[model samples]
Target chain A: MSQKVTRRQFLNYSLMGVGSFMAAGAILPMGRFALDPLFQGEAQGSMITTSVKAEEITEEPVKVDFSYEQQDAWYKSEVTDFVWVYRDGDQIIALSPICKHLGCTVTWAGDDANPNKFFCPCHNGLYEKNGKNIPGTPPRGPLDQYEVGESDGFITIGEMFENELV
Target chain B: MLYNQKDLKVLKDEIEFIDTVIIPFAAMDMDMKAPVHAGNLELLQIVCVQLEKQFKGRLLITPPMMTVGEDTSLLGMYTTQLREYGFKNIIVLTHLQAEPGDMNKIRLNEIPLENMSDDMKMEMINDEVKTVMKSVISIWNQ
Candidate 1:
């Protein structure tokens, strides 16, 4: 004799399978969001404050210098000696004059031959005002941007970790 | 007048005179906002004449050769042409003043003029000439 399946029993099995699929769909995105920061692998770094007045600075860029603090590891103390900042209107972006390639200072407006390009004397590394490296230049990546805050007309900035520099 | 009187003895004299040529070569890698040797090209010219006078006929001094070109210049046709035609009795010498210890393996050819005053620099070159001359004379006479 042939056996026949009950309709009530088939409906219950189908409902349970759909319910489990819905549960998994809700949980996976939430789990990834919570752990994304650690997986992204970018770290915040050190920077200093500058009292450069926004009104005083014009559209013409000028080199601003300052000092900052850095911690290599626990129990290790470092005071970063130098940094360079550029200001245009409400926008203030500071670049570590230090080259990403080998820790050389990239100079600003040195040669009239190549205008508006930051040049590194050690090797022919060039970058535009936005810190994007010129194509075919020795610098493999753009300069790092800092997190900036203007408090009482003084500019404070923080660097992202070296790995984030790219 | 330079020859001393000692009866001009036997078939040959014990002492021999030889002409020695001294070349001071500097490897310059830095930019030439300066001269032949560390912002002092004119100093090299003055040193040349002083060397010629001190060594007299015993030495012939070569003009400064700018090592501005890369090491590949050593193989280039121009370098070979210059070597074949311009320089005579040429031998490569290399040394530094910063050698360790009181006594060590010293190749006199590449020796550096120590942190000496201009006067001392000249004297060092003179002494170098004397040492090299003695060797050159011995080899030639033999």
Candidate 2:
């Protein structure tokens, strides 16, 4: 015995097939759009790589230069900034050069009197090796710290945070 | 700090701490030396940015002031206005030879930055910034 499909059944089957295809076409993009941020977050991780090698960081603090793209209003430019990196025992530490007093760049041993300390030339602010704000200085708090890690024997800098050592 | 709305709001109350103002002067003559003028303006801007970063607590950088040639007659009046606005020191940063009365003027070196590599440009700009910074510091010490 041979069986033949009815016209109504044929229409229902075709309609369901096309309807599901169209629905998927529309929903797939929306799903991707909803999860776009996750994809981007994985692709553009917060860590920025620097040129300095991990082994180059000694016990004495040295300036490590890093460049990153900066967006200001409608303009985009590559800005180069530096951080103070040093080796403390087996761990590496990075500190922001911005003074806590008033946003001035601090230097390592900038002031002659303050050897072995980060000194702010603008107002004579001083910070200890551990980023602690010394007494009688203009800095109100310790220097901010940056998340640091080693990748492929090179130093990679990440998000800045409050000084944990202090 | 910069001459922007947010900074100006804070500047009104903190004029005592931020007593110094840096005016970036540039020449915009549309002649054969237009490119040279443009290069000087770029170098001036870079130096000003570095200077601001070094002395943000005590310095306020103004917008670049453009003029045709070395006619700095308008600067005298501008300086008076700035002095009247409670700024104790008004330093003019430029590559031109201009005498804006008795106010301090820092004449930057005219380097052909366009003909150099990125690293060389940065090194040259940094040296210029250091010299300008030294002058500013000496003025402060005085």
For every candidate, the chain B TM-score is 0.38, 0.97
Model 2: residues with Cα > 4 Å off, grouped in runs: A1-44
Q: What is the TM-score of chain A, computed separately for every candidate?
A: 0.57, 0.77
Q: Tell me the tens digit of each residue's lDDT in model 1 across A1-166.
A: 9977789888999999999999989999999999888877654334356667645555445555556555666765544333456665567656666665444456676546777877764346787866778888667777766566665777666654342333
For each candidate, give the interface RMSD after superposing the true interface residues on Cα. 22.3, 1.0
Q: Best by lDDT, which number?
A: 2
Candidate 2 — which pairs collide? none
Which numbered prediction scores highest in DockQ against the true structure? 2
Residue B96 of model 2 has an lDDT of 88
For candidate 1, lDDT tens digit of each residue in B5-111? Answer: 42123102311221223444445667663333453444444444543433332333445544553342442333354344432233222232332221111235432
- Of all native A–B interface contacts, model 2 reproduces a fraction of 0.70
- Which candidate number maximizes TM-score? 2
Q: What is the interface RMSD of candidate 1, in Å?
A: 22.3
DockQ of each: 0.01, 0.62
